[model samples]
Target: MSRKPIIGKCRLCGEIKKLTFEHVPPETTFNNYSVRILSGEEVIKQVADPNNPPWDFSDTKGTIQQRGRGGYYLCGDCNSKTGQWYVPEYSKFVHIVHSALQEVKGKEFGALGIKMKGIKPLSIFKQIMTLFCDINEGMMGDNSLKDYLLNKTSTNFKRERYHLYMHIHSGSVERMNGIMVQFASGVGLITLSEISTYPVGFALYIDKPEAYNPEGVEITIFSQFNYDDEIELEIIIPKLESNIFFSGDYRTKEEIENAIQESKDN
Candidate 1:
């Protein structure tokens, strides 16, 4: 049965309208499969149990989303416009990276200089920002994002308030976290959100401190490109493994296992 139309505040544009499912990452970018969406607390409970093995989510508690990982956070007009304007180009860029990852499947962890050809960097970046908007509602609600996304040619996003980072992701879990504040060892307190799925992951830092040093390559420069300016460029993106449920956790499988064993030993 088709679900009834949901009425709510649109994440983008902040208008009260009929909401539609806005995929965090576009559906074509490997987000169409069935996934069990778990809350951060649920994941922490599992991960906190020292007896529970890593990557074993068979008995985990979560709502099984048959369609994909997304929610009705956008209205029809905003959804249609962003989907038409940004998804295609973003999907192409994701596929290019996916193909590159496949070629170097068993290789060691290192940076890859991918020579992406004929890509609309602005559209790709806007699509990523769209994902950020979808994930966050009241916390990161800035009208600048709506204006930046709605106007295809506008390059006036508030760069001082936001920074976008990307990394190649290979993990067993997909994540979509709302705005969270956490303290890093050297970085003190930082505010950020993360969306990590297959082949790619993105972290959006909100009001980042000068001392905050984040993993992955920053791509906030993509906002400067014009709408139709297709260009060839190479980006050196590092591969990071997200084997656990923690946001921005990039411990490898071997590293995770070793840590688990050490915990038991101690």
Candidate 2:
């Protein structure tokens, strides 16, 4: 059977037109895998061995099968423009993350100082941030993001005091964690996140300037509008949050609520 093209409202422009699959993290990281798409939930996970935190997940076997087969939400124009404007920077960042992971195999993350050049921080930030919005709009059926993506642009991340924190992450059990997009609300702000579970794992935290920082974790606060030429980055292996969990063990809604509370208490 042949499938028909989807005619829909553009996620960015709101124009009624043909929509296309906007790979949440772009296709470079997902390798076009057919996977489960989850919105408003965590994909179940375990640490494998809590005692062995650095379990050399770099070589773990498995394919990330939960990237949600990409999301069909953007019109062709918005999709193409985003690709041209942001995907290249995204690919570069993904490559840097992969290299950083290989360098710290069997070792602790962070402590390794990384510096990148000729980069547009906002371009990359917008790319990741869009995935969160795309999921909210397409998967969760929300409209708040549509208006933001089109007009209400804010270039003053530092002035507005909003920051994006990032880290290198790999799935502890099998490293097949695909690009996972999640939304966490409460604690005085909203958190929109995207994580990749490949050996070169990544966590990008977008939160309000006043949101509570998780206890004991030191994050590098970065701004979108500031770094157009160079970006100073460090790769820390982030612990899985209640929102972004490993994929395997299922969590009941109640259990998930408990975990979120635990995170807040910390």
Candidate 3:
């Protein structure tokens, strides 16, 4: 009988004894309808395949089949400990934000309208901001030490922070507006490009495509709101380096203008 070859060390930790397979994006989040659509099932299935999976997908030949499908290896230890940031805690945080938004909407329109008008509106906005901020801090915080031969030091701590910031300021905000429109009526449409341009126009550039070195990708945000109470948000992250595309929706044109003013004030 022929013996199977072992794949090398863990990406995060350089342990030589037993390497655990890790998912670039956690598999638990992959099952969602949005994720499945965004990351096609064929791509997922190919990643999950035992024999001819992607380099980021598997460890050993037979070991891949042993793990069934959906997940890769990390020995026993790294598998258990890796990627805590993008797992249950992040999901829980998103749920909290959604719940808070619901509570805001449940109040009488008159009270809610008043809340949105005055300085006290800062209090409500603060609550929303706090939840996201805490989530970002918790997930991207420093990792605990492991005393293994290759796993002694920390891994990708800075990159993880960048990812967290991108997810919050860019991804989460866009997602929140979409969820608001899905659950509530009378939300004017805003595109992702509109929102992204707001910061760019104000010269508050938090992220850029060139900074990340993604070949030729260009990202921009936009938003749109109609007088008839419809909201639409679109984000264009094109592979063409020359094209700038980003978009999202705001509650209203006044809101968008106010946000720009707020950005200036800050």
Query: What tens digits encode model 3's per-residue C-alpha lDDT throughout 161-207?
Result: 22111211221121211111111134333111111110111111122
RMSD of 1: 2.0
Number of the top TM-score candidate: 1
lDDT of candidate 3 at residue 139, scale 0 to 100: 16
> Candidate 2 vs candidate 3: which has greater TM-score?
2
Q: On residues 45-106, what C-alpha lDDT tens digit does candidate 2 reach at each position?
A: 22333332322233334345555346677888888877876678877877775676567678
lDDT of 3: 0.27
lDDT of 1 by residue, 13-57 (tens): 788999988777889999898888887778888888777766667
Off by over 4 Å in 3: 1-6, 17-24, 27-73, 83-86, 97-164, 167-266
- Compared with the true structure, model 3 gives a TM-score of 0.27
Ranking by TM-score: 1, 2, 3
Span of ten consecutive residues with least summed lDDT in model 3: 195-204
User: How many pairs of residues in model 3 come into backbone collision?
Assistant: 46
lDDT of 1: 0.86
Comparing 1 and 3 by lDDT, which wins? 1
Ranking by lDDT: 1, 2, 3
Better-scoring candidate (lDDT), 1 or 2? 1
